[model samples]
Target: MDVQAVLKLADELVFAKTGKHLEYLEEAILRGTIQGQKYSQIAEDFHLSEGHIRDVACELWKILSDVLEENVSKANVRYILERAKFYNFSTIGNDNLTINNVNICPQTPQSPQVTQQPQETSTQPHIDLGDAPEIFRFYDRTSQLTTLENWIICDRTRLIALLGISGIGKTTLSLRLIEQIKTHFDYIIYRSLRFSPTLNATLTNLLQIFPQQADIPQNIETQISQLLNYLRQYRCLIIIDDVQMLFCSGQLAGQYKTGYEDYQLFFKLIAEVNHNSCLFINSWEKPREIAKLEVNNNYVRTLVLGSLGLAAKEILKDRKLSDEEAWETLIDTYQGNPLWLELTASTIQDLFGGSVSDFLQCDAPILDESLQAQLDQQFQRLTQQELAVMIQLAKESEPVALPDILKILQLSVSNLVNAIRSLVIRLLVEVKEEGKTTFFSLNTVMKEYVKNRYMR
Candidate 1:
């Protein structure tokens, strides 16, 4: 078949499988592959990063492999598509046309046999969203949503860590994710560890969601084994929120609080073991094991959420704030956190008569009582070294390089490095990359809070 015919048939096959046409990058990768070009060549031609090109190609290949019932890769994608196209076109007039054993008819837009249907009696996927807060106004997380859907549905990632600071909306994003991908799993469960539930108790609560599980296991090991068995037997999506509550306060990030150490082993199993289920951990600070697991394993990953960018404007608009031209200034000062914006907007209404410009006229960013309390919880969790780093960063008017920080604090390199790393994990410090060097600084709200509370 010619190149156009190959591309058309490939798009059809992909649409038949995923219910969507090929995306721009996917089409680029396919076209490049058909012309026998390397990924680096494709990247250079399209003015994109080679790593991003390869990642898109990998996901595209996996999709085609599932549709064609064969291993599809950059090396053999053209051949596979040509073969499938030839078979499909030749059998168009037959009573039954099949591509890779999946029945399809080229005359129709959607094939009856290829469309996925619920197997069980209930048409809806089983969902147990216990205590998941309702997301009334979701801002633009389109890119994040797509990345997570690809990871969970396409890549089948077993374990994922959704991390961010307080008020950054980790819980909100996860809730929205459930709404988007709930149809793909047999069971979905969301639980909060805010109360610091024991591992056994958490396992029991989750197991109780399944049918035919009235009797609870007495042993912790048995409970874990049974949970794993259920995970392997059915496709499940489990989300645990407030994971930072399980860590000890006044220590480096990720140190488990007393009696919460077993959770480390449980999370490790979720990442290391073979299972169809995905366990998503949403926390202010990631578990220590995640750092090691994600480096060596493709199925394990962490997504550290940053600002909402232009989406923060929606929050301000909803609050009915004035000074449309100065909205970006307020958003930047608060670092685009939704809760922070909401609290600051309320302050503007109460004190500044809904004027953002007036709020900016202050000598420094204002941290109201509620905002300070939210930040207090985060700062109280820092170790002495982390606090020292924060104090130094708060004193700087611009982002400071690592060498300057080391010289200013007179700290051993290792100690300073670990403190900065932990602070980053906790999302307390902001990092800026300039060529080969990295600079660290605090946002306006953080700096003001530090100056008021610690550097007094």
Candidate 2:
């Protein structure tokens, strides 16, 4: 088989079995193998150990066997490669396989003829939000929307917390909800506390949403009280995105030694004592004080937004593989985070032969700021040893088993276990089970971020 044909078969086999395309090492081995190099010679040329070459060869056999639905050996591997040469595999590096080129291939009497058809397009109305169109586009979370609407319109719950990791669409959902229900409120305001506003600055911004008659007070407490009074008289919806910033160690309601103490009092007053409604969206754990507020059933509601479901995947059917199984695998890798999916989908379609799983498994850059911030915060919280372990996982071609991690880190079993458990709680790592073996991988978005920032 020619080098190109061998590479194509290797790519397909790797993706079909492990949801990852051939990496640099695998590609090098395939290139050398196609040039008629023996495994030992290839190992010596690459300056790798003999065992490493044998391991790669064995893995290649397994992958090809799975893709071909039959056991593959060194002898059959060449036969499979020859057969693959007759069938063109869609690949990124080669550009000659366009639809027009397919038309000129000579047809044989026994060969079935196939024609390409134009793709259908959707006419769904796109919501535009100026420079940030994605901010208003509702990707998923239908259940959260229903629950939010019920709380606002029917139950009249005054304060709601929309909590989730970054890029899970908390801010988008809040904005979409406000666009739907703003007519019901006398005033609507969206505030981003991501810059960690102080009490004076927060109150100053709040005053802009009120009428001139609602005179601003110099004192923070008085201003807040007056605002509540106005809210009681008039229906209002206030949204605070990135509330974690406001509660960070030194600012706003998060200013107390434990972060903002008075902010908790302020929220309690707004939700329990006053009639106004507020939406708080954040990436981290809710303040302990807010958890206490759950006791007051009539005042507040909390919605933890999760990944997008099957319905949302339909929105991008025209752009890529458009296959149900491929879409599901992509979603599972990204945990259905909208920003990650959108960013990944286009790239997956353009490169990697429309293999979403392969694109995800391959190292890629994170383009979303929210995802980056979440990863930064989590990494900042780790100890040096913990960070070391994380880098090991990130560098791995696949998930690492517990024993492998210990061996790689040269740490005692207990210490390794403790580090893994800590990462699990922090949502940075996830455990995958395959029979008796357990493996750990950095969560999808985080994996790329950590690998880029620390590993390489």
Candidate 3:
């Protein structure tokens, strides 16, 4: 039962009880709920207050409850509706007809056409956005979306790696992309490897989405082969998120965990094999296979998501921040990262009454506990050398060149180069090129975090 079918039944039930159709807000709430979006997201999307949305949803549930003869809520509306649909068909007649175990009663000549079961057939793409985050408000990613759409629809890129720092909106951008171009593909499946599922388990989960899964192959090789065949047969757009979980935390970027090595092979085949499908992975660190694959195949691509730039002012605007001129300074301080700016905005709201300049007047950047905790997770994943480089950069007020870092850290040229390269890939260090000299630095927020947490 998809969202549209559920909505149709809901409208029918609502009209029968109230003699009127579902209102715009009520319909928006229902659609959002059915799609696993939160009430806050629904409110933001519809330009309504959260309290108003919640009140509307409460009234909706009460109305649905009265008609269904049971309690209905956001949590169980889908289940209750499905049960009601089944019950409605089963009680239609004394001599009931069953189709595929679902009772379909024979309609009399006088019965209305609405008594017939709705056909589920459609040309709409099969989209399974499993646990994808609801985008409350999409800041401008016009260029990014255009590039990704061109790659998938025009270039037919087989595999893409969406890389960015933590909370830089990689997942959000991908979800937005799916919304924009979902109709172009036959299948759209999103799965997260956040818990680090094994290759076999991941394959099984993905394969289950397709039909004829009554007897899945027991061998890993056969499972992979079957999935490849399906990918070739249909234009599937699969998004595997939280791919950084597949790598070892203590090692350098792109090094897989010991037992998860076979993922390397799986990804390689996806890039090399002939298929009319696109499989994109989201991660903080690029996979080891991507660099090599991009060189060998034009279809393999990588997009490193950067700061939101001027578009990020929308976030501050929603936060109701003051001192428009200071907004740019604040954004630059936080490097225009949506989540970072959001957290800092709350701090300003609480302590300075939404004055961005007041927050900036403090001796140092505010690294609230929540922001610190998030940065801690990213720092914890760095190697010792990377940590050393981060500490050195934190000590500098301005961007520093390579020779200065070498002089301060007393490290080998190759070691410094490797550490800086890894840090860049990790998106922790900021790089700037002036003339022929390259300089590196950390954003104000990160520099304060490193100083307070490590340089003490």
Candidate 4:
């Protein structure tokens, strides 16, 4: 086939299998291969990286192999082109066998006398990682982006705390924000405490990211002082993801025992002084002293991200459902979590025969015990009546106002309001204001689990 026709067919085939289009570089490589250009020549001509060109060519071969039902190689590029010509694809090559008039036969035919072969089925889809992009995908939290941006840019707010439940995209959002604002600072460092690296190891990693000619300091105190001086000398943004793993409780912020005392001191220094702008993304609440310092002192700000929004729902729309309502129901049931949405979307095509509403409304729910444990830890001190009010709101469809909650739970308004305020203080339920009225929503994933399990 002509290069244009082959490119067009490849585009259609790629979109048919994967719900995304071939990137521009992929198209250029395909056209170059059809023209019999050497990879080296193509790389130099386009001013492209040689490795990048080869990667694209490899992906193109995989796509063509799947579409043509045969192995495609650099030596057989011409053969593939002839096959395309036989399939009535337009071509400029001389080996065309009546390109426009050629009749391509089907791979299999239906006949009474013919024996048919059984089709094999597999549970997993074939994914070519070579074709995947290098960038990580962020799922949700537009409001969180704005909050982080404002804190970083505004002089009044320096240290920002990103608080959320586990697996709620805290790390992902922080990484994305850093990627966006990386150019604003001379140095940007992302350190994860998920593995609970020791103070020495953590400082070593930080040094590796931005090397200094001076020898490493011997002790944690001197090391931290030198690091702080380095950061203060240059505009830097440091992010500490999974910061909760470093601390045991909120009270003793800087009181780590034995081996971890250095880390505690590091945190204490960061909290006490304002040398560099730092962002801490964690699941648990900060230590009371740290939080108090942030609130009373104007330099630090706290931003808690909840869940995905309507825009995040659009990511699943290409999954091929029967209608928009089914899609909406699925998004609601999964709370627009990217991983959950992707997992559920893959199986949804088969579930079309089942009732979408019934599927969403089912009583069986996946117990996210970690989230439950966190909430329990936060609410263990509350009284039974207060817990009851929280449970009612957690299971409610609409945001239950104080009066409605009191009526449903058969409790006094004063008592119900107190419970609601307690929940809000603990960041269990978010109170949203709309003019004179206020509404509440449980933490995103919490709402999904509660509605699916308790309210049915």
lDDT for each candidate structure: 0.85, 0.61, 0.82, 0.57
Question: In each prediction, how many residue pairs overlap at the backbone (N, C-alpha, C within less than 3 A)?
Answer: 0, 5, 0, 2
Cα lDDT of model 4 overall? 0.57
After the best TM-score superposition of candidate 4, give how far the Cα of residue 14 lies from its true spot, in angstroms: 52
With candidate 3 superimposed using the best TM-score fit, by how many Å does residue 292's alpha carbon deviate from the native? Answer: 1.2
Report lDDT (Cα) of residue 243, candidate 2. 70
Better of 1 and 2 by lDDT: 1
Ranking of predictions according to TM-score: 1, 3, 2, 4
- Residue 227: error of model 4 in Å? 1.5
lDDT of 2 by residue, 271-354 (tens): 776454444445443554566787755557777777786655854574546456667766766778776677666666777677
lDDT of 1 by residue, 1-456 (tens): 488878877777776666688988788789888998899999999899887897788778766756665547677889888887776556644644578566865446344345232211234678999988878999899889888987786676889999998889899999999988887678999999988999989998999998865577978888888998888777789999999999999988999988889999999888888777799999999899999899998879899998888799999999999999999988888888899999999999999999999889997489989999999999899988889999999999999998999988968999999999999889888899999999999988899999999988
Please estimate how well model 1 matches the true structure, expressed as its whole-model Cα lDDT.
0.85
Clashing pairs in 2: 253-260, 254-259, 254-260, 255-260, 256-259
* Candidate 1 residue runs with Cα over 4 Å from true position: 1-122
| Candidate 3 lDDT, 33-107, residue by residue in tens | 988899899999988888678767876885665455444778888888776667563433345433234333333
Using TM-score as the measure, which candidate wins? Answer: 1
Which pairs clash in the backbone of model 1? none
Task: Output the lDDT of residue 267, model 4.
Answer: 59
